[model samples]
Target: MQAYRIDGVVRQGKTNQDFCIDLVAENEDQVREKVYSNFGSRHGAKRRYITINSITTIDPSESSAPVVVSHFRDK
Candidate 1:
């Protein structure tokens, strides 16, 4: 497993809100799917409403701080 940082925006009403999320996944595809599922469940957002700008692998050392982490399970 690898840590990934996904940067994107989600449509909320008439505006788009930026988001930075960190998760443990094997690849970028997994990261994208998790983001869609997570935001959809939490905010009632559809896949079309989410726009992923970038997905990058995160160094484990850089993730040692006290940041909120999200755990995703593959469906």
Candidate 2:
């Protein structure tokens, strides 16, 4: 697993940082297992304001570098 530093601006230009997680497993099942075992809480009780910072891969065939995937605000 790897951690990414997600920097963004909130309302009123307040800076915030979020920890974006990325990992590669042997298969889809392993990915699910890891995410569930570790990030199930964050996934289950969705609070919004979640965002992705980057998604770099160890493989060299990627066309572009990792970028933001999504962003939201908690109500």
- Candidate 2: pairs in clash: none
lDDT for model 1, on a 0 to 1 scale? 0.80
Worst 10 residues of 2 by lDDT: 66-75
Model 1 is weakest, by summed lDDT over 10 consecutive residues, at 66-75
- Give all TM-scores, in the order shown: 0.82, 0.29
Error of 1 at 43 (Å): 0.4
TM-score of 2: 0.29
lDDT of 2 by residue, 1-75 (tens): 322232222221244444444454455445445444543364342223333333344432221223212211110
lDDT of 1 by residue, 31-69 (tens): 888899999999999999999999988775566423323
Q: How does residue 9 of candidate 2 score in lDDT?
A: 21
Which predicted model would earn the best TM-score? 1
Whole-model Cα lDDT of every candidate shown, in order = 0.80, 0.36
